[model samples]
Target: MDPLGALQEPLFTVLETPVSWTEVLGFGSGALCVWLVARQHLANWAVGIANNLLFILLFTDAGLYADAGLQIVFIALACFGWWSWTHGGGPADRLPVRRTARHEWAWLLAAGAAGCAGLTLLLDRATDSTVPQWDALTTVLSLMATYGQCRKLVESWWIWIAADLVYIPLYAYKELYLTSLLYVGFLALCAAGLRSWRRDLVARIAVTA
Candidate 1:
């Protein structure tokens, strides 16, 4: 097996060294879903849709509204992404990694900012959650990151990597240290994605050159 895969093998536990069976199962499902996503299999999104449901409940119980809500959106986008990658981009077209277009980047930033404001106001008013604003900011950015991933944008990994780095501490603060480690794994996966996708992009350029 590849070194990256080997490294991930040891991290398949849940909730500290003690390892809860429930967390292990959830983490395993989530990991399998991500592996499929990395392989560009359309079925990944289906697995992800299921994983999102599980995570929605997990995050909701943890008081992570932004994450819970984002999971719902992920379900919608995962379906859209699965369809688009298969049919929208041309019946036989391959999903290729590409740099983010200027307009697309602008849209992501604007959407993130708008999402922060909107979520902050709504969460603040709707509940007594302490970190509603932070929750919204992270959620919006994470939404953009996931959307970027669905499109196979090279920069999506960067956005996700950044977001996950921030999320590590945030999850820890919420006493979900196990989930924090999961974000760490996500950060590593994002870096791996950057490398793998860059290789793909360079190969394409080399062939065209």
Candidate 2:
């Protein structure tokens, strides 16, 4: 009868796995958040923030400190993305999807490399994370994808796809099977997002042409 313990208690059994409230809510909110993002809806940020909070609790309980910490970062990024979509649109005040620039790609790649290296070292030294390298890799990819999404860069979907691929196996190894299944859904949503965003970008280009 502790409150936190009650919250973490099993909601039901999924394939003999005790599914908790955090995982179930995280799964639902995560799916909705990504679906909204794929549809270019502003509410995705709000839903995504809620999902991050739940994952923070879920990851911490699972001893995935790196992912737990990443959820905090995700909250901040979601706020910035919210403001960006509302205010960063030039003149029209409506952000439109665009392609990543050549120079921007170089910087993003460099950031990914440095972030992965630094986070891997920190997680390996500071925490008992068994999958530090893979965790760090996915963390960096998620960061890149979030930044790209905030900027409305169509390439964000590619980065998301890469992260989802890593996340599926990583979560499965961590015994977070529900979260693993969620990432499988994310992979499909990301493909749809890529196709949709690319269509928007092409339409914009044609309008200017």
Candidate 3:
């Protein structure tokens, strides 16, 4: 009876697939990270770093190569975001939340489309990823969302909500049940985050005016 072996054993069955400890840990941490993000807490970045590391292993083992690679980028971005939240505001105490402008939305949409096309081609040709189109869509939009979050832009949540919608079904099809469930949670949090940031933006505008 090995102790580590017990941890690796299936905690339960989901649609005949074994749910293991690894996914459980990843799911928990991911949930916490999203909650923190929704609340506009600076600690989200640190928790996100942990979540990214866990998901890197989880995604790699699950054969989601692009997702695994995305975790690496997430790790780096988490570090940058941590620093940005702490110090990027300069003379201000913290970065202020702002709404995304119309022009910015146009550019972001264009970039997301281009990224999806390029990543879909790369993944389809270069890797054995089964859900290449959806994977690429989520991955590229996630990048945009992350950049928006680091800048404290309110529209990041909107982008995250879109990505999570696609990710939920994609992960489920891959039989990564816990990760799929986590994305469902993410969708709700993204909605909450949108409202939270909108209120914050309103307050900021009121103060400035």
> What value of lDDT does candidate 1 attain over all alpha carbons?
0.75
- Cα displacement (Å) at residue 57, model 1: 1.0
lDDT, residue 190, model 2: 97
Which is the leading candidate under TM-score? Answer: 2
Alpha-carbon TM-score of each model against the true structure: 0.84, 0.96, 0.91
The candidate maximizing lDDT is 2
Cα lDDT of model 1 by residue, 1-209, tens digit: 76423333444433454333334445666667666666666788877887787677667767888788888999999888887677645326766777899999998898888888999999999976778877887888789988998788989888887788778888777766676777777777677768888898898879879
Output the TM-score of candidate 1: 0.84
For model 2, residues 1-209, the per-residue Cα lDDT tens digits are 78667768999876788889889989999999999999989999999999999998999999888889999999999999999988876547878899899999999999899999999999999998898999899989999999999989999999999999999989988888899999999999999999999998898899889
lDDT of each: 0.75, 0.92, 0.86
lDDT score for residue 133 of model 2: 94
Error of 1 at 60 (Å): 1.4
Evaluate model 3: give its TM-score. 0.91
Judged by TM-score relative to the true structure, which candidate is superior, 1 or 2?
Answer: 2
Task: Sort by lDDT, best first.
Answer: 2, 3, 1
Residue pairs in collision within model 1: none
C-alpha RMSD in Å of predicted model 3 compared with the true structure: 2.3
RMSD of each: 7.0, 1.2, 2.3
